[model samples]
Target: MKKRSGAGLRARVGAIFVILAATVAVVDGCNGQNSIVGGACVTGYVACADQCVNTAVDPANCGSCDVVCPSGVACLDGLCGGPVDGSSDGSALGDGSSGDGSAGDGSFGDGGDGGCEPPFNRSSACGACDVVCVAPNSACLADPSGNFVCAPPCTPPLVECENACVDTQTDPLNCGVCGKFCPSNLCANGVCQGATPGDVVVLGHDYSSGAAGSSQAKVLTNAVFIPPSNPLRVLSYEQFADAAAVARVKSLVQSAAFGRTVVFTPSTTSADLASPTLAQSYDVVLVYDQQGGAPANLTTIGASWVTSLSDFAKAGGVIVALDGAAGQGGMPQLLTSAGLLAVGGHQTIPAGTPVAVVAPADRIGAVVASPYGVYNRSVSLQAVEPEGPNVIYVAKQLVNGTPANPVVVHKIVNP
Candidate 1:
């Protein structure tokens, strides 16, 4: 080991520097553009002429240092093109694969167990997101990959009415509540009323469904004066009649000489007082013992019937009304309109022979007695309107001053 002076030391240091530089150059050549720490390509970018660029991210070359992006993606900042917000070229791509299950930031079947393709939810089918389903009538089938198919399977059966559904066959109001119901046996209110010659006579030839005179067709059949050969034809409208009365009328007709020639019409719905044919077709229009006269759907006989019946009476048609129809409120207005008097709050004839016409004089008489069998001195008589030259058949003096109010006022109109 020779000791050297300052000048010799300088020369030795310079030589060592040169050798180190050479060694570094050799290492760089072998490693090929890499960092000393790792064998990675150290960006592998080529400085061609002026710009520093990675040929892999350039349009000319891609993948390897010599490769580049295809036509769609362009190189930018030494890398391939980044995603655009709304580019028109239409291509699928992914930025990163950072996701969990359904809660992942990635798309619906993106990153889960087997790409999350099984257990299809009905809510997300037919290209819908976050849901899956088969449409109505579609069958659900599984694919080879265990994915559900979404489509209608087959046509469903038609709906039909069944069991305990009301029979519209006989119900006048609700004929055949459900299902196909034929007009079976001409039933009304569950009771069959067969049509006969009498039904034709009473309802008239022009009568159709829900005729007003349907009940009167039955009543005229029971009339004692109506001959079987020449039955009286009448059409009348009644709101309601007593069930017992209907049975009675039915029985009376059954007992007649003819074994039931005239039959009641099968159905009689609510009557329309507006029809004049209902008025003119009948000889006698009698609304008898009618309860619930002011029907739920109709106004009381306050104006129309009052006015029309007055016209009918003037035309010489006899209109008989019994009970509620002839009660104080209804009959008084009608009688007064027809020019007649009606009196009776509390008055009754003798239980047995209370009402009678005096013989030879054509005078009507009634003897009213108290509930205790004592005959009250005063009697009541109601004189109907349409007053013309008429005879008083029988009477009782009510007021002491006048010729005594007639207890029984029988008027002979056109007599």
Candidate 2:
């Protein structure tokens, strides 16, 4: 090409630059239409089918311009499947989502907290950051394979030491305490040669004592024993009417309170039940009911039994109402009214179905072994709002899968 004059060359170069600019715009603008990339698409608008449209509140183009939300779910203020609350400030999931469902900085190993702790490391966090090592019986420690996990200490006399759950009460290799070898083959009561044979007062009772002279005492006694907590006697009171109640009484008698029972009275007409001495003597009262009603005049024997129990509870005596007791008359009403318990109701779960036992941070799980158990019938009481904030909720709800209502609760009354 021949050299041109300065002005002519400059004019031709400017024209070529203009042409290139136009061509570049068309090439990068998504087939000459609006695109999510570059200046063609603006914020507060989405690029869909050659157009930039406001998807923030559009029913047809919901969260994204192309997303036509279903009629069943609403498209609300740029959020899909949310109610039209008339405000738009919350962040939402975008189509550019990671398959794992987490959008922010993702570096934590499988289900691990953000560089905080491993999933199975019980000492730091177990299962997840939110789920920690729990229950007095359980502790965070390593197993035989050396992986961190949450595990229960070996039964009673046994203890956890040197990465193992060892029976310190009997182990010769680690007798009395861990690593304390015994000279003889005897390790008793966790001490070398300290074995002392004594009567184990494992006690329990059935709520219903069948037909006047009949009994299910053998069955009650034969069934697994519930360990009694001594020096804190529990009065296992039951009616003679309910088979279910009686069956549950068999279970209740195993509570720590049972070991404290000053007297054993299952009959509805038991004089001790109404005795003021009973309230003064015992630390706890476990009431098991079948018909949801007291025996004739039982509530009014000398002193109103209901009044006595209420006073006892008010005076720091723990009153535990067992199966069907929620449905029991005035007593339950008093308890419910006081906000010590959720109100009366019952739900019979399907046979063999395990109800999820929600245990809070307390000694509850230690007393009740399993976090889940199969109960044919459970006391389902609708929770009532408490008068004051003095009420302590032990467990919110028991559920097979879906939570129905509150089950276990506690409260210490004030004068």
Q: What C-alpha lDDT values do all the predictions have?
A: 0.32, 0.41
* Candidate 1's TM-score: 0.29
Per-residue error (Å), model 1, residue 342: 4.8
Q: For residues 113-193, could you state the per-residue lDDT of candidate 1 as single tens digits?
A: 221132332323211112223234233444466644444433222112232324444643232222212223354533323
Clash pairs, candidate 2, are 169-190, 176-190, 207-246, 208-246, 232-260, 233-260, 233-261, 234-257, 234-260, 234-261
TM-scores, all candidates, are 0.29, 0.35
Top candidate, metric lDDT? 2
- lDDT for 384 in candidate 2 is 44
Assess candidate 1 and give its lDDT.
0.32
lDDT of candidate 2 at residue 393, scale 0 to 100: 39
Candidate 2: 10-residue stretch with minimal lDDT: 196-205
